[model samples]
Target chain A: MHSLTRSFLAVALLASVSAAHAHRTWLLPSAAQVDGKDPWVTVDAAVSEDLFELGANALKLDGLSITDPDGGSVQPNQTSTGKYRSSLDLKLAKSGTYRISLVSETAMASYKLNGEMKRWRGNVADLKKEVPAEAEELSVSTTLGRLETFVTAGKPNGTALKPVGSGLELIPLDHPSEFLAGQPARFRLLLDGKPLPGLTVAVVPGGVKYRGVLKETALTTDAKGEFTVNWPTPQMYWINAGYPARVNVPEGQPRPPMPAKRYNYSGTFEVLPQ
Target chain B: MQKRKLLLTAVLASALPALAAELSVKIDIPQLAVAEYHRPYIAMWLEKADGGQVTQLAVWYDQKKKDNGGTKWLKDMRQWWRKGGRDLEVPLDAVTSATRAPGLHALNFAAGKAPLGQLAAGEYTLFVEASREAGGREVVRVPLSWPPKEARSTGSKGQEELGNVTVQLKP
Candidate 1:
């Protein structure tokens, strides 16, 4: 009887301690803010699975809430990866204000994309950091569907750049002589000064082949006009688009044979692993 | 040992498609990166001089990365992307290694199989693109005459970052 009573007390004490520790480590779920017009931030949500810091956000996002300054909210769930996540149907389409914030009752730390929280003086509740604006933002279109909203930006009256009719852009990287597989090459672009949106671009080696094999992640173009497509193995291809032909005919012209331009931009390279 | 034999048998089976009438080709690139650093993924493919997809051979990338980040670099690899970036998913093991640096890389086309050299007769362009991590990008093209994949191996280059690239190709 005496041991039973002591065990009960121990259980109650342990539960309380656990609750306290969880509360102490609690942080506000973080959200990135994109302010242009139809401000929609792409949530990479790459949660680090193992953070060595004792009080780090252990990558579990069960109790997180995303709130926009314009009175909008969303709950991002984890995808196949431990790091990546996406919010469901939340749109920040307001004109006057734009900000997406996340705070975890658990950790109390908030993350805003492109925000540098260095030299913060007081508490995080009123922390103010300026998020840099994306110059030329473009919406994405995949076999899945078009990005939820149109990409918008700051500039007072700049007309919006329409999405590529087929949601595609022709990217060209130039180099002198042929590129040997292991040797590095270089080139510039005709649209260097133009404001271009982020899109999936590819390298088509041969001037003739359509629907050639692709190198993964290598298809995406970063903010910089730079792109990288790893060779699946060493091979050959041509230049073209990633999407199916969706453009309409002008009442008379036949469908262009997938726009394979010889445009003096052709070559070969060996693809041996490093 | 049985697995090795099976793999060998599979390679032989795949090679059966190459029992063609003529032609032979190969590429050589030494000094590649195989560590935990950033090396650009490269792609090579064939097309008629008029610019159309013919065949896709290889893509080098790390499958473990996110958001198609590994394949995202294909844009700079202009030629291959045009023909089939959207369609091909080169199996991870085919391109996986530690990491890659710069130097020589080579692919060979043997006799009686994919007679790459014996093209009946016409103009063709072989293209390549490099999408590096820390540096800039580049694409090179070699203009070849018909029948023989051996044509002085002419090529065009890009800008300041990717060092001088030279394609020493033959028939």
Candidate 2:
């Protein structure tokens, strides 16, 4: 009996350790319910487990699945978080209000019907509600702010242009109309190819305008030398250009011109219907 | 006398779409709904009925947008992204537009030098593809008749806000 008892205790101990290693957690997500407007469900969840051995924020949808009441699974896309993306082909699979079973490495968390799963606009609204109104003022516009965020070691710091790595390189999404009237596209800036750390580094004009109205934005870049913005509306747009600078290393075959005329890169294009 | 002869030649060339060549087509764009007041990127072109490309008509583009001329956004058109948007460093400026409220839009086109009549009579198609920033897309095709029927306008529906899109030629 003593031997049996000891063996049972050992098994329990092993199980507990295995559970602890998952290190999964529910990143804060805001619950929402709106009228005809599509109420979005934004969860800052993270799956930091070795099962998939995904990268730090490998949030793309490989394991995560959502089944609606109609017996169909949901497909997610327009991934603000690139770590894990699912259902990116655009249209949702029409799950019709079902439970979102979030199965992490160790945590088996789930969200009840929560609210109406109308059209999910996981953007603007989600980032606006809980996020500071000031921050919203910054994130809501389609112009680049002066904020630059740096993410290294453990602390994610925000600063101006003083970046840690080489510099910020902006890469835009591949769309048919690179230039459009009112749509918001993406321009990604990287530090040595890898993400700048924080989220995105956007490029925009001095300000933005809407509904025959114009307003200048204030929010600047964080430290990682990154920001996000939508494409300007249909109008003549001219804004100062500035990007995160890189560390001036001395050991390279060649170097760029002094101070780098890249300070305010400028070019122009047109947008008209054919 | 020489100028008069040139004028006559130009008139004859422009009047030929009725004799041999015909123009017909449809344009479609895939749709993805997102949240933003911006319009989708669009691409329009011509394709031979037998699956050969004829020429690129236009690309809905934005000039004031960031990296607007990057040439990368061309891929959003898919078909254009694959066939040409990916490579062509087009000489002309981009053609884009602001987002439209829920509704329909009809358009028209004029004749090209030597016009449709100049081409050898055969089957052809008109293709238009559109991709919005935070909306759905559509690719519409309209079969061109040997001679246009007074530039009739018609369109198909899209999942997102995009409804019917009709393009005809004015007599």
Candidate 3:
């Protein structure tokens, strides 16, 4: 009976790991481009098993940041969280691009404690305080993720598109707001302020509930870490890229040991009709 | 001294071309038999051979709307908006005007002027885009060389939203 319970616990753990991979986190905006003065844009943040259909959980807003066109920070006018999604309304008084992003670093661990399997998710500092030192088969991983969307009030500018030089980021070679169907949009990928080349990026258009096929487009970056996407139709698109690396821990560190680090970047872009 | 300067200016003027180059544009707003129709917002601009915007010549919108409400729909002209229209502060006395009725409107621009004085002698394309409420959008282009060695006329036609668009260059 003991061996059978152990085997079942292992299967459950494997299923949970795959479930995490199936869920995608995203931010969807009401409008990508606004022409009038002092326009307002509402954004919905969520994580779901489908591309953009809110189903899994409401994404936490603890790391939310809004960068205006002039590189100044702005606060959301209103914010709310429901069971499936978190949303915010932002007033775009500025005349250029605004970047709404949620950046977070989380440490997650799965371990066996008292003959039972358990999982813990929180910041790095809480690992020791929450998970007992006597826990067996403890495996910890850290994830640094950024999910973002862009909106232009009057004209699209590059001021807010500048990368923060940490984790994975997408640099637009062309204006993000100007993506059109049948036209190729170019972007570059950077990891920790350096080029991340030879990576496969996935582009999936939203409205999956109505379409019969997912029709996902996979693109690869070149030596310059640049990739081009020829949008098939006019709709909101979700693009994501991920990279994993083994963490190098210094000798005799007092903190809990994290074995690996994962970097994830995702963006929501709207492509207009030609 | 003033007389001498005038004499020098006259000599220089005589050395140059007798007639200043001028561009005359004729745009036709088509009358559609649709249930709901609004005067189309039009944007006319000059672009270089490589598709870079050179200058905005004209924009026709409903300037009488309350508190610049007409500017809200300017994004419907997506091509021009992406080119440079989004950056402009409308009600600009130079290039902005009220929407026109369904008819042909002729506008003349002098070469040595505020908007056109910066144009160099090269090949350029004129882009005219129009969008309407509850209607379709259309774009028409006319390619011509600046400071034409001789008079020339070029034009393009649209099936909807707009009619014939003509560009006449005078040397």
List where candidate 3 sits over 4 angstroms from the true fold. A1-15, A114-117, A123-125, A245-259, B1-171
- The candidate that wins on lDDT is 3
Encode model 3's per-residue lDDT on B1-171: one tens digit a residue.
Answer: 999999999998765643468899999987664322467889999998865756899999978777998798798688899988889888786699988989899999887775676577778889999877534567899999987877788899887777899999877
Question: What is the DockQ (computed on Cα atoms) for candidate 2?
Answer: 0.01
Scored against the native two-chain complex, candidate 1 gets a DockQ of: 0.02
Tell me the fnat of candidate 1.
0.00
Write the number of the candidate with greater TM-score, choosing between 1 and 3. 3
- Residue-level lDDT for B81 in candidate 2: 74
- Writing each residue's lDDT as its tens digit, candidate 2 over A1-274 gives 6444334433433333223322322222222111233434443334432111223453444334444334445554443556542212222233123223332221111111232111111223343453433321121111111111111111112121121233333333322123465665344445445554443221223112111112222223345434444454543222223343322223222332222111212112222222
Kindly list the per-residue Cα lDDT of model 3 for residues A45-111, writing each as its tens digit.
9997556777779998989999999999999999999999999999888899999999988777777
Docking level for model 2 = incorrect
Report the C-alpha displacement of residue B139, candidate 3, in angstroms. 40
Candidate with better lDDT, 1 vs 2:
2
Give model 3's docking category. Answer: incorrect
Best by DockQ: 1
